[model samples]
Target: MPSPDPKIISGNANQPLAQAISRRMSMHRGVKVGLVDARVEVFNDQEIFVEVFENVRGEDMFIVQSTSNPANDNLMELLIISDALRRSSASRITAVIPYFGYARQDRRTKARTPISAKLVANLIANSGIERVLTMDLHAAQIQGFFDIPVDNLYASPIFALDLMHHFQGQMDDVMIVSPDVGGVARARELAQRIKAPLSIVDKRREKAGEVAEMTVIGDVTGKKCIIVDDICDTAGTLCKAAEVLIDAGASEVHAYITHGVLSGPAVDRITKSKLKSLVITDTIEPTQAVKDCANIRIVPTAPMFTQAILNIWNGTSVSSLFDTQTLEPIYEPLYPGLAIDA
Candidate 1:
C-alpha cells in the first residue's frame, strides 16, 4: 500500500510557508494535513530546544525550515527538530529548506577557511534527515555534499510565469542580464524559457560583499533589461549593475531574484536605485521593509513546493512538475487570490 499522507512540521524559520504548504496539501488530498503540534524555544543562554507533541511513530515527516537570517538559530532548530522526531520513532524525516544559508560558502577562496556549505550538508545528513528539499541552491555542486537524497527545486518556472504575465506581448523588447559572469547560467535559463536574448555583467569583486567595476558583455541598448541572480544581499551589486545597464542605454531595468536576502542597507539601496522594479520569491520570508517597498514585489513558491512534496511522498517523478516542452509548471491551479505578502 502507498504510504500515509506525510506529517508537516516546521521550525520558526518560515512558518507561513509551512502553513501554506499544509493548506495546499489538504486541498490536494481532500483531507486536512494540519501542521504537527511542535514547539521550538530558545532559552536565556540562547540554547535551542524542540519538542514534538504529536505521536509521529512510523509516520513520514517533513520539516520546513529556512536557514535565513539568524542562520545559526534556525539551523539549530532544524537539527534539533530532526533529532526529536528520530527519537520519537518517525519513519522518515525530510528537511524542507527553502533558503539554504551559508550556501555561498561552497568553496574556500582563501587559506584555512571552511567550506561551510559542505559542512552544513554534513550536519543535515547526519542529523537523522534522510532527505533534503530546497530551492535554487546557490551552488548546484552542494547537492553532492549530501549522502542522502537531495531535491533542489527551481524557481525558474515561477519567475517565468510572472515574466510572461508582466512582459506579455513585449517579450521581444526584453533582455535578461546576469549581474555577474557566474550568474549567466541562471539568467540564460530564464532567457531561454522566455525566448529573450541574454547579456552578462562581468564584475570584479574587490572584496567580500563589494563589487568594484563591471562591464556589460552584450548589447542592452534600448532593451528592457531584467537582471537575474540567486541572492540579493546588501543590494550593492544589483544597484551598481542597474546603473551600468541604464548608462549603457537600456530603456529600463527590472530584477527577478530567487532569494531576497535584503540585509544591511539592501532595502535602502534598492529604494534609491536606478532599477524600475525588483521581484523576488518567498523562499525567504519578507520583512516589513520588503513589504513596504513600492518597487519590490513578492511571488509565492508554496504551490510549487506543495506539488514537489506530494510527488516525493507518492514515489513519482518530481521533475514532471515542470513540462520540458513548454517550461510551465504542471500542477493543479493554486487557490484563487493567494495573498502575495504575509
Candidate 2:
C-alpha cells in the first residue's frame, strides 16, 4: 500500500500563521492541499473537545499551534489535538509551537516554585507527539526537558537581514545592546553579523515583574543601538534599557525581539519609550493595541517556517536555513518537483 501524504493541521492559538503555512505548503509540489478540518469546542462547563474531519491514519501529521495569550486554553487545545491524532493512528505527530508559553518558568526562583516548563514538556511527551519544532525558546535548556527530538529555530537571521536594510551603509554607527546580562550572547551574534560593537545593560531586578535599575556597560555615545532579546512581556525591561542607553548619549535606539508576548501595558510602555522604533516577529499574533502602536513593526515568519518544515520532512538540518548571511536555504527541497514558494 502507498504511504499517506503528509498532513498539516492547526489549533485556535494562531489561525493566521497556520493559514500562511498551509497556503505555502499547498503551493509546494504543485499539489492542492489545505488545513485539516479540526474543530475545537468549549462547552458551558469549560470542558474542551476536538474534532478531526479528515482521516489521519498512517499519515505524517504536523500541528501548528502556539501557546500564547490565554496560555492554559491554548496549551490544553494543543494537547487535545495531539491526543486525537494519536488515537487516529497517525504515523507521526510533530508539534509546531511558534511561541512557547510558560518557557520563562523553566527554573525555580524560590524553593517552593514549580518548574512549569518541565511540567509542560512532560505533558506534551505524554500527548503522543514524536517531535517538536519551535522558535526562540526563552531558555535553551528547556529542550533538555523533553525526551523527544526538539528543533529550536532562531530569529536572529531574520533580524540580521532586516538590519542590513534598516541601516544600509552605516555599519560604523550601529551597535547591538542586550537589555539584560543574560541576553549578551544573543545580542553579540547579531552585532558580529552586522559588524558592529556590542553592549549590555546590567540590570538588577528586585523581584519578579519589577526591574529596579539598569546601567549600560559599554559606551553608547553617538551611535545607533539595537537591543536584542527573546521575550518581551510588559516591555518594562526594553523601555528602561532604551532610556538608559539614551541617557548614556546614544544617538538612537531600536529593538528586535523574537517573541513579542506583549501582555498588559506593553503597547503603552513602548509608545512612551525613548526608542526610535521596535521590531518584533510574528511568532505571536499582534493584539489590537500592538497594531495601534506607530513605533512598532512586525516581521513575518511565514517564509522561515515554510522552509523549516520542508527541511524537517526531508530529514535535513533546519538550522542551516538562517545561518547564512543571505539568509538563504542551505538544502534544497528533497521531494520531487516540490518548489520553495515562500
Candidate 3:
C-alpha cells in the first residue's frame, strides 16, 4: 500500500518560505504537500481569529510557521492551526519552525521571571502538535522542553557549502571562530567539516545588547576568520568580535549565523563593522534594513529542508542527508588546531 500524501500548511508568518519548500517537493514523484491559506483577523479587544481553510482529515499535516518577528501573533497562529488540524482529525501534526522566537527567554534571569520557552513548548504540545521540526534553535536545550519528538536541523552543512564555494581553494587560510565561548561546539563542527583551524572569541556580556570585553583565544594572526553562531540579534557581539579579530592581526573576518533575527540597528552595525560579509540563512525573512546592508548575504536552505521533510514522511534516516556532494568538504588542512588548549 502507498503512504498517504502529507499536507503542508503554512501560516501568515512565512508563506514565501513554505512556498519554496512546496515547490521543491513537487520535483519528486508521489509527494503531495499543499499550503493552506491562514487568514487571521483581529476582532474587538485584540482577540485573534485564525481559520485554516482546508480539509485535513486522516492526513499527516505539517504546519510551517516560524515564531519570528511579531512572535506572539505567529506563535498564536501556529497553535490555532495545530488545534484546527487536530479537531479536523489529522493523523499527525508537525510544527516546522525555521526560527523559534522567545527562545532566548528559555530560562529565568531574575526571580518571578517566566520561562517562556517551556511555556511555548507546553502550549504547542497541548495544542495537539505531535512533533517539531525546527533548525538551529537559539538554545539547543529548548528541545528538552518539548515532550514530543523534535528534529533540530543544522544550517552548518548549508553554510559550509556556501563558504567552500565562495572561497574555492583558500580553505586552509580560513579559521572558524566562535563569537563567544558558548558557541564553541557549533563553530567546531563547521571547522571540522571545512578542515579549518578553530578559534574563539572570549567575550563577557555585561548586559543585553552589549559586549563588555572580547579576547581572542586562538592563533588568528594572518588567518581569515569566520564567526559562527546560531542567532545574530543586534549584531553587537559579532561586531565586537570582528574588531577583536582584526586587532589580533587576522587578515579578514566574516560571519555565518543561522537565524538573522537582525533586530534594531543590527544591519547598520554590520555595515560599518570590520567584518567583510555576514552570511545568514533565510530562517527569518530579512527586514528591509538587512536587505539594504551591503555586507549581508543570504543562503537558501529550502532544498535541504525539503529533503528532510520527505525523509521523515518516508521513514528514512534524515541524518544521512547531511552527507552529500552538495555538502561535500571543500578544505583539507594539514594542521588540526583547537581554539582552546585543554
Which predicted model would earn the best TM-score? 1
Better of 2 and 3 by TM-score: 2
User: Each prediction's TM-score against the native?
Assistant: 0.94, 0.93, 0.91
- Tens digits of per-residue lDDT for model 2, 57-150: 8888899999999899999999999999999998889999999999989998889999999999999999999999999989899999999999
Ranking by lDDT: 1, 2, 3
Displacement of the residue 227 alpha carbon in candidate 3, Å: 0.4
User: Cα miss at 261, model 3 (Å)?
Assistant: 0.5
Report lDDT (Cα) of residue 302, candidate 1: 85
Off by over 4 Å in 1: 1-3, 324-342
Q: What does each candidate score in C-alpha RMSD?
A: 3.8, 4.4, 5.2
Computed on alpha carbons, the lDDT of every model, listed in order, comes to 0.88, 0.86, 0.83
Q: What is the C-alpha lDDT profile of model 3 across 1-342, one tens digit per residue?
A: 223666788887877788988877776544655566556666797677777676667888888899998999889889988888899888888899989889999999999999999999999999999989899888889999999998888888777767777776687899999987888999998888778999988988788766788888989989989999999988888898899999999999999999998888888889889999999988898777788888899887677778778778887877765553433421112112212111
Count of residue pairs whose backbone atoms collide, per candidate: 0, 0, 0
Cα lDDT for residue 233, candidate 1: 90
Mind giving the per-residue lDDT tens digits that candidate 1 earns over 16-76? 9999999989988999999999889999999998888988999999999999989999999
